[model samples]
Target: MTNKKRLELTWIGKDKRPKLEPRILLEDVARSYHAKHLVTDNDIFDNRLIFGDNLLALKALEQEFSGKVKCVYIDPPFNTQQAFEHYDDGLEHSIWLGLIRDRIDIIRNLISEDGTLFVHIDDNELGYLIVLLDEIFGRQNRITVVSFKQGAATGHKAINPGVVSTSNFIVLYAKNKTLWKPNRVFTARNKRDTRYGQFIDNFDAPYAQWRFITLTQAFARSLNLPIRGLKKAVGDSYEALLSDFVVANAPRVVRLARPDYDAVSGDARSMIDASHKTSEILRLEREEFSDMFFVAGERILFYSDKLKLIDGKYVAGEPLTTIWDDLLSNNIHNEGGIEFPKGKKPEALIKRCFELATIDGDLVLDSFAGSGTTGAVAHKMGRRWIMVELGEHCHTHIIPRLQKVIDGEDKGGVTEATGWKGGGGFRYYRIAPSLLDKDKWGNWVISKEYNAAQLTEALCKLEGFTYAPSDTLYWQQGHSTERDFIYITTQTLGADQLHALSEDVGTERSLLVLCSAFRGNPERFTNLTVKRIPSTVLSKCEWRHDDYSLILQNLPMAQREEETLKKKKSAHPSLFDNQDA
Candidate 1:
């Protein structure tokens, strides 16, 4: 009999190798919501909530949204070594890195030139994640690290025995920092409180009583008047006389005012007198406050506090700093170190980021949308959004939450505190399946479930083509470039089928088709360029063989102590360095 140990070793070796086609990691089916006769319809709004793999969904979005998004906020899996209830939560550190690497690479491509990206992470992988972000987003594109309080309690046993809680990190990266800035709108309360201080607005001076001063010396100088011993003659009313003299000189000239306009409207005069009258007025002058004003001699007119009624100019203050003071952490109930549920995000967090980095009507995209928080907040802020989620939670949690927001029923600090009362709607979509599949001859054939036209549309979406022709039955999809049309075929096309496809492609123009065959006639289809399948589609999938596990396997076999030290060194070069190598 063969040795059992050798057989076990062979089995172990076989099991350790990666699979070619891994099982679908996160799968949740939903009914079709947008596609009508293979073209976008006006019935569907610009905003979207996609329930599917984020990577695949991003690929799908390439057709409609690449380089169009203005802001993106993603709180991806932080590889915290904790189990996740929704997915294969725990991955080897290297595997996690590889996964994030691919996803971030695609995300970087999706960002417009003026777009910004905000990523939330914990201490577990923050440094490594930063390095990865630098590699994908480029070091020059880094914005800032916004620190947020995660939890303030450390369960009585602190690592330092003094520090009680921990803070989370948000790493922001922009496509081009110099090209754009976030927009801010001041609140009416802040304006009234003057807590932001006395800054100029429209170059107008403050309308304080001191600014409208009545000078006795100036009055005496006017019309050769003398104020010598004026305290005896005019008494306390000397200043009032000066003011009345200035008012007579000024005369409240109404350049553009209607000739028939009346500032002495009976109702307005009564309201102003009633409101300004005080106990001091009653004590000083027995006459009512209304009767005290000598309207005939002085040009005194009651002015309401409303700025709209004034004829003054305003001056702008210093531009606001993009960083906001609000945090979204409150009552976040979860055991796996995840914040909120799979389909919920704190509104305050999104509001802060948007207010700092984007303007109204900017496009916001969140790929790993555990909850539809980003979309909801973007909607409330008057920005458009594209949300991608890859779990059943997208339907049960995200859809209902967004529906509540749309119907004005949600009050979870989002609608009530933020004052968001549903004004727009979103179109929902599920990631369409890949169009191409191998046949007996390893040849490309279109799937029967999809007609030629449907296959053409799917190919277009897969290959970054935004539109397809409805009138003609051209096998190729729309042009991304002048000579290229996104083309896809399920089975290998034979010589005759290739000729037919070429003839349909037309002789006048060349075709850049993405297919499963390169054996077509070069002379007849001289302008045609063929990109094979699997290569085109695999880039959009989380191919595990190309992921972190393979990277970790490259490391030489070493003792546990050495491996730990290596990881620590990689994680924190600032902490550990110059020790004996």
Candidate 2:
């Protein structure tokens, strides 16, 4: 067998991986906002808004949300991308890729088999990000890259000498390409269609007696002007005048399209052939085919069929395309009732993501919450959502904006369009602090911050067990399987205590006992596996380490381990503390 050479994006610290702690969420009751009364029967009250570092947040959600989220969208910081143009081997660029790679790996596991992932990035890191995602989600699972026209160069930007940039990109990928099926969607078009050039003179007449005329002639006749005098009459505004006429008589005007020989459906080809010979308009009578109109071998498309109802007005629309210039970002400053400076994304953009990949009630996740646009849009669209943010704005901005959405008082950005009368709610949670801390002697130990329950749960997560303590059995604090159990405690267990625990475990069952100390003859207890706490967990993770940061606004310095030890030595001159076991 031959080994395959593969291409991948490499950076400093790319090989070193983080063993993220599966930290538990602690909800703040006062911060979690909800509607006073239910306004709709489908009001969702279980959405989550997490305040913490996003990478750790993703790890915490891994166990319960793995392979369950239907859609995942993240918009990470892109300011560091300024390094890409200069081609400097900057540490910030490497750190950006490293942190983003970590989040993407975790997110891939969180998405369902049929789910999709959308990463919003600008052009600077877009190339590198595509390669990274291709490696994680497989090159075959890549769907498309959308070029979003966030704004047009105007105001101060217009004075710039060189070409101005206004486009950002959204890279899309499926968790499993074979199982993923995306919904077809249409977006509002910025311009009207000019293809409906033919107007049926007697549109309501029977098929055999129908008369067709060019739209220019029809427009000229309406004004009692001859066809030759039309161009001189309307002059430069002729196209605009014809467009207005087409909109008014949209159903009567038609565009003639020839059917592709090989690609056209069997029924359509047959219908086109029969119509050409009979010289009559035909309607596809087959129930299996969509209702279609054909005249003399050409498919007839009415201007009315392209109409889309948008913003309380019927306008032209087309299939959603890779270039998304129609989404305007002009007045986004006043939206969401909060000011996030450069971070907040428009809700309509996220709503389109939901329309493409999910339905109402599907679960959506955004690890980089960044002004909480994903959660706010998901809430209004009736999708359950989870958002993670480490910034203080998680309170100052996100919670208040979400409160307005819940109270139905927010009347901006898709709210009026969706008919959202609010009535949904989200729970607020913050990531729990680390479970282990170092002693003054530089020895690893259980943190004093954890209470008994928190300690047991943290240990359960580390040991790969479900934390479900049995009410009847004190020895069963957690379990990996039906008959396999784990028990943790701070007390020392002697030979007699070990024997008692083993007898209770019985011969058919097995138990992992994690205690401060255990004493026994090696071959005595067949049912129990004994180990000491702190020691068993010491090598499993980067214990008590805060060596890195996910934010890449500037070059980061690693937290000095020696400095930490010195500080701890000064704080605790005596090694033994009152809580020591």
Best by TM-score: 2
TM-score of model 1 vs. true structure: 0.58
* TM-score for each candidate, following the candidate numbering: 0.58, 0.84
Backbone atom clashes (below 3 Å) for every candidate: 18, 0
Q: Report how far residue 378 has shifted in candidate 2, in Å.
A: 0.8
Compose the digit string of candidate 2's lDDT tens values, residues 473-503.
9999999999999999999999998988988
Model 2 weakest lDDT span, ten residues long? 81-90
lDDT for model 2, on a 0 to 1 scale?
A: 0.84
Give candidate 2's total backbone clashes. Answer: 0
Over 4 Å off in model 1, which ranges? 1-44, 87-89, 154-160, 184-328, 331-344, 438-451, 461-467, 473-477, 482-508, 512-522, 525-581
Alpha-carbon lDDT, every model: 0.56, 0.84
